[model samples]
Target: MDDQTLRRAVNATLMPGFQGPDLPAWLAAELAEGLGSVCLFSTNIVDGDQLRSLTDAIHATNPAALVATDEEGGDVTRLHHRAGSPYPSMAFLGHLDDEAVTEQVGWGIGNGLRAAGIDLNLAPVADVNSNPRNPVIGVRSFGADAGLVGRHVAAYTRGLQAAGAAACAKHFPGHGDTATDSHLALPTIGVDAATLAGRELAPFRAAVDAGTLAVMTSHILVPAIDPDLPATLSAPVLSLLRGQLGFAGAIVSDALDMAGASGGGRGIPEAAVMALAAGCDLLCIGTDNTAGQLAGIREHVLAAVRDGRLPEDRLLDAAARVGDLARAVAALPRNDRSPGSHVPDPRAESRPEGTPHLSPAGFWLGDPVHPLTAPVFLRLSSTANIAAGDTAWGVADHLAGELADRLPGSTCVDAADLTELAGVLDAAAGRPLVVQGRDLARVPFLVDATAMVLQRRPDALVVELGWPELPGAIGIATYGSGRGAATCLIRLLAEGSR
Candidate 1:
């Protein structure tokens, strides 16, 4: 291949994220040179108008370039990262077992993305959360049951694509059963072949059958398939997706900067080559990518192709696949309107006049607890997972702000031990206590603290902002910490009092 052909092929497979809300000079030049895609992170976004302008600038530079973001609509939202998403999570939809509602949520998210000028959404986590302790995929997954996850994955894919934005079913071969976060380190899926086929592969198959335009690869090792390489760098795993699942769409690699892919002394550029050779059609270089890093990756890929380490044919195939997806996305109907302008108001559905509008964000565990009167919000905090980052979340703050007059005192504490729990409870000062937490079931200390609080103050209301598994607590599980869940929980509390 000549230098121009090689450069174009290399650029087509590279999807890098840049700093700031504006398109940088380097990135604009890259886009004009046939860079197939660019990923937008929270840093690149400010508001709908800013996002639209940025994406419009990208498209203006290269009309064929695809713009993508991780807008999974729940905890992993990009468009609404600052305030949290206004939509229910997959787990909430799965708990309701309503496919129509799930589709509507997908459509709403897609419309939001479409309005933002984004072409692709790397979302609809197809991983079945079989392991409750999964640090990365907890509430992101639909459910623990493979069938339920598959059903919702298909529904979400159909809805997202139907709304003019391409949906990419993610973390292929499943990242649900592992306890480790791939962002920090590599996790090995220890399940056998049959177990893998029965549990993990089901959702990917469903996604393919649903006409998903892209499938994102996970960075975990499946000893059942190949003991050495992670799925992002395993041809056998990619073949399994292509042959058995019959997925002809693009295979997107998780961020190469992740420790799971770049750890053990391998750099992002090398990982990009390995992922492409392993059958990934597009390589996500990582967030806040610099021009120097992009140049390094391009040089590494070109060298690999010239040295015959990565075949020219393989590079061409990957680039062609990316180009095809970009063309398909370009052909989708454009929604130039402002975000959420055309999407139906999910909360506007008919309800009895004067009754509280209970959105899908609220999932009642036990009976409705005693209503809030002079409530004191006590937050039991946990370490934020790397995937969710340090985004603003939780219902306590939102509720406190909304019901400031009713709230006497509100404090957030790490209730890691009995002493901390005692302090937290004491801070409530015998007022009607409302304990707020996220993924309480995953952390032993939070569970123990919550249980002790409930035992001491059985009248206390427990609100779980993450996946709800707090047994014996008469609480509301919002299934997410997004603004939607917070609003729903507040309405439920207000309604109960009335």
Candidate 2:
């Protein structure tokens, strides 16, 4: 098999889409050229009807061609129609602390996707968000606990498969530990192989053991495994994923266009060649650059195989796997409808925004609350008057600003101004004194100071900003940023019936 033959074979399994000044013509051209598959992004996907028609048209072009998307039921959903399914994300489910609820969310997501003519869900992110500073994948994951995330991934896979759709556990080795975005640049993992085996690889292993249909490789570098190449282009990582973890499913490469995988040094075709050489079965290129960019790879892949740069046997093997997956999906029982029929979620009832919703208030956060903004508001305004000791910094000033605006007549006292605060408390003896952003673990003296303040005013309202179970305050957990709306709600609480 020469480069041309391998190029032809490689062209046979692409899940490609197109973009240009004129997209419809681009779509037609890609189809006529015998491109293998289509992936739907936010732009390519419109409503359910439009998506169904688009998928139908693509299938009509090549009856055996595969169509795919990344509709993971949260912010990543493609068909976010008003009539579409409503499934909460991993963050919400993780907060619920019920495995049963997690499984049900998976089932709803899978059924909804299947109804929408999408056979693949590039979902169930197996990455554990170990680094709090990670810009992406924060609450998108289950939680910081790897074991909990693994269990949820296994459950999600089962629920999705039960509904006749395939689930792909993503960022194969792990992407949660990295602080940098792979879309911008390559992130290197310094943890030893043993540490990876313990923390990073746990969820992936669980996913593989649960018989997930596909595993999408990450672009991050794991020096302990393959120092030079990222996992998506590393035979060692893919082999470990398949051989050691016993993952017999299809291995899909993350988008070749991402800088972590392709952009900085290599061209798309060259990266595609390297990826295929590294043992990936399916190549997923976004619509933005698939047509002209990969045009070179189509021919180069064929040439590589012919000249022994790529193995002909590997090409055939990969193609067979892709075909088998398609056949498996096809052989499953079909759902014939008006091409856009789906059952609605029974529990989806409208609740007016700003209504007081029951939620768990605590010092520590394990999972994100549903209707996330509501609980956030409740916590932020739960207390009335604001007070602080001397030595308060910018964080204290920020809290003071929030209090002065949100809670009218709220007084902010510096530690140097503690005497003034005591006088004011004496004036309104039983009114609540709100203490914000106290890190007693770092400054232990603050513990005694806070106790002294509380002792004088037993009616004081103390909001612990940092950890769980603050010794002398009501704990409000703001798991991440962008919780300002929640702060407003808590401020409203402080003004009431005092």
Candidate 3:
């Protein structure tokens, strides 16, 4: 192949992320040279206007280049990272079991992305959260039921695509049954073929039937299909998605920088080559990627083609698929919704009228009781998983101005700081105490601390901001820590105080 033909083919298969909010000079140059796509993270976003400008800049350099973001609209959000996401999580929607509401939420997320000039959204996680102890995909998933998750995935895909943003159902085959986080390690799904098809692959099949524009591969090992390689590097697995699933959309690989993909003595460049050979049309090369890294991956991909390890025809086919996706997205009617219009705080107007009265925000475990006359807020802090990162969560910051003096504000206590729990309990001596936490069931220390506090202040109300797995506690589970969930909890608390 000629040098220019080889360069364009290699560039079209890469979807890389770069540093900062503004477009870096090197990335701009690459876009002009035929880089097919770029993925955005929280660091590259400030607010809606800046994000729109960034995407516009990307398109200006290369109109065919796709702009993608992980705007899952719940726990894993990039557009609304500063303030939490305005839409309820997939778990909360599943708990409600209302397909219309789920579709509306999906449309809202896609509308926001479309207004921001983003083409693709890596979202609508199709995994069934079969394992409650799963660390990565708890609230991110719709639920444990295969049928429920599959239907919701289909609804979300339809809604998102209708709003002009392409939806990419992710972590293919399944990533919900494993205990390990794929970002940190490679998780193996040991289930048999029947279980895998009935439970894991069911939602992906639904997504394909729903005409989803793309599907993202996971860095997981399914012993039933391919024992040696993860799905991103396994031809048998990708072929299952392509042949059995009858999906003609672009196939995207999960970020190659994850330990699950690049670990075991292999670097990202080799992994990129392997992923393309495995049938991934577009490779996401992780977050905060540098110019040198992109160049190195391109070189390695080129070298692989020259060495006959990766066929030139295969490379061209992948690039063609990516081009087709971009062209499809470009052909859609322009979304004229004003930028930043869909991101309003959803506490008041967003909820559908006559909805189930399981409290306005979340369901209550017990009878409605206001045990607090004088209240002290205690926020239990724990290590956020790698996927959620260190983005601020909860309503502490939002409630500071309103309840500054009377409530004495919220005290943040680390999960490991067991000694401080006593002092916190002591501080709320003659008052009713309210505690907040995220995924309390997942953290042993947080669970023990919550139990210890409940022992002392039995009337205390627990507010769970993560997944709603905290049993035996008189609390409200918001199902997520996003802006919508936080606002609902805050309103509930305010009503009780009044």
Q: Candidate 1, residues 341-422: lDDT per residue as tens digits?
A: 2334454453111112336433755664455666666667766676666566765554455555333344444455788779
Candidate 3: RMSD over Cα atoms? 3.6
Please give the CA lDDT of all the candidate structures: 0.81, 0.60, 0.82
Q: What is the TM-score of each candidate against the true structure?
A: 0.91, 0.69, 0.92
- What C-alpha RMSD separates each model from the true structure? 3.9, 10.5, 3.6
- Candidate 1's C-alpha runs over 4 A off are 333-362, 399-424, 470-474
Model 2 lDDT tens row, 1-498 = 354455546766577655421236665666665566677665666565777777777777766666777755433455552222134446544545566555655666666667667777788888887775454565456667889889888877776666677778988888888877777788987889898888888989988887688888888999999999988889998888878788877888888877888877786677777787888888886546645566766777776777888788888888777777777666654322112213332222332111112123211422222221111111121111111111112123335445554455544444424454455556544444544432332234445545655688654444443222333344333221112212322433443322
Q: Name model 2 segments beyond 4 Å from true.
A: 1-8, 20-23, 32-34, 81-85, 332-498
Q: How many residue pairs clash in each candidate?
A: 0, 22, 0
lDDT of 1 at 319: 95
* Model 3 quality (TM-score): 0.92
Cα misplacement distance, residue 143 of candidate 2 (Å):
1.8
